[model samples]
Target: MGVVAAERIKLTSTRSPWWCAALVIVLGLGIGILMAVLSNDTEATQGTDPFILSATTATGGVSGFGVMIVMIMAALTVTTEYRFGVIRTTFQAIPNRAKVISVKAAVVAVVAAVVVAIAAFGAFFLAKGIAGSGPTIRMGLDEATWRVLYGVVLYAALAAVLAVAVGALLRQTAAAIALVVLWPLVIEQLFLLFGDIGKDIYVWLPFANINHFLSAHGSTTADFHWGPWGGLVYFVVFTAIVFAISLGLVNKRDA
Candidate 1:
């Protein structure tokens, strides 16, 4: 539809989104190379799977950082308009404010997802190159590496959508981003410190549980898993619930 295409163009025309996309690629690959270089001389610990360490380290600790930035970008993308009074112009142009927001959400989600996928694959190859032939697994179209390859992108994109939903509640980029980022790190940690319930309750913590994707270990609970696809599922459900709540707000709000 013309509306969707128009929305896409508007979304992509912005410089920040493009720079964020570039940053995702550059930071991701940069970390991968750093991991390979730092970890090159180190052999896989005997009895431990090299692939696990390879996945974890060459992928590195920066994985969580990408998700947070992605969420911040999403939050800022939607909520910033409210602060700038751009929402009035956007709605005035479209007239169908509901559809505009819906399309905007969909457009942002899809674009972020696609960019993350490309970045993940690019990072994989960049890492593979730095690793050389040293203690490396086979890379091909039909390998288990495919899971790791796509999971990075899937997780990042989902994080953005979830943030968009959360942003809708606040409608302010700064507050939404602060709350979204701090929720898992600070507040969740505090709640999780209380007792045994902390472990169980925190296990379902939306963004934190996403790391379960990268874990070779397993989930702590039944309701907390989607199996090997757990990370993807966790993010999907989180994104959906957030978006649903945002939809209610969107319907109620002026723009």
Candidate 2:
């Protein structure tokens, strides 16, 4: 608990977290509003699912841009320690190296969850207001609506944890950030350009699974679709595998 608290303090004492939060809020709301303004009324139809529209708006479309900020935070959490030679001091204060990693992961998970939840809700309501009496108006809380909200929150948290795991594995800030950022932004997109096989495989990617979770409807592509709950499970399992590998590397290596 003390270690977690100290980490939280370190995060708060720095300006980066605040700057990241600002960027998330700005992107969440800015992109959401743009989507709301540009979206056609026809998109509010049954096939589109107005609830999904609002949800997507709140989340800055299906691309998960806000999670990118959280991802940066996650990578920096450990990578920053290495950059500043603070890991040795952290190891000295906490003899159980694994415990230190565990606590840092926990702290990041909790904080990312809260931050993304706020951003999601903020974007949702802002879009709702812009939507007005349009087709994207807020439908009362229903199972699907709630599910989308829950999935968005879960997706953000998982992305952050996955980035943290990657950071732990790589130990270099630039490398970790590059891998996390480029994989989704460039690599995944590039892979999807290889025709049907790429599309089939792309759905299995973390960001794609997250998009599936946010959608009220299932995917049209039979092979790619994993439904909401199934997508969540896939993401959790993928993140767990990454985190497990990171734990193994941390245990075997020097700080």
Each prediction's Cα lDDT score? 0.68, 0.77
Model 1 residue 126 lDDT score = 72
Tens digits of per-residue lDDT for model 2, 178-229: 9998987798777667888888788878767766777755544335665677
> lDDT value for candidate 1?
0.68
TM-score of each: 0.82, 0.88
What residue pairs are clashing in model 1? 57-60
Write model 1 residue lDDT over 148-188, tens digit each, in one string: 66666677666777777777789987789899789866887
Among all candidates shown, the one with the greatest lDDT:
2
Instruction: In candidate 2, list every pair of residues with a backbone clash.
Output: none
RMSD of each: 3.5, 3.2
> Predicted candidate 2: what Cα RMSD to the true structure?
3.2
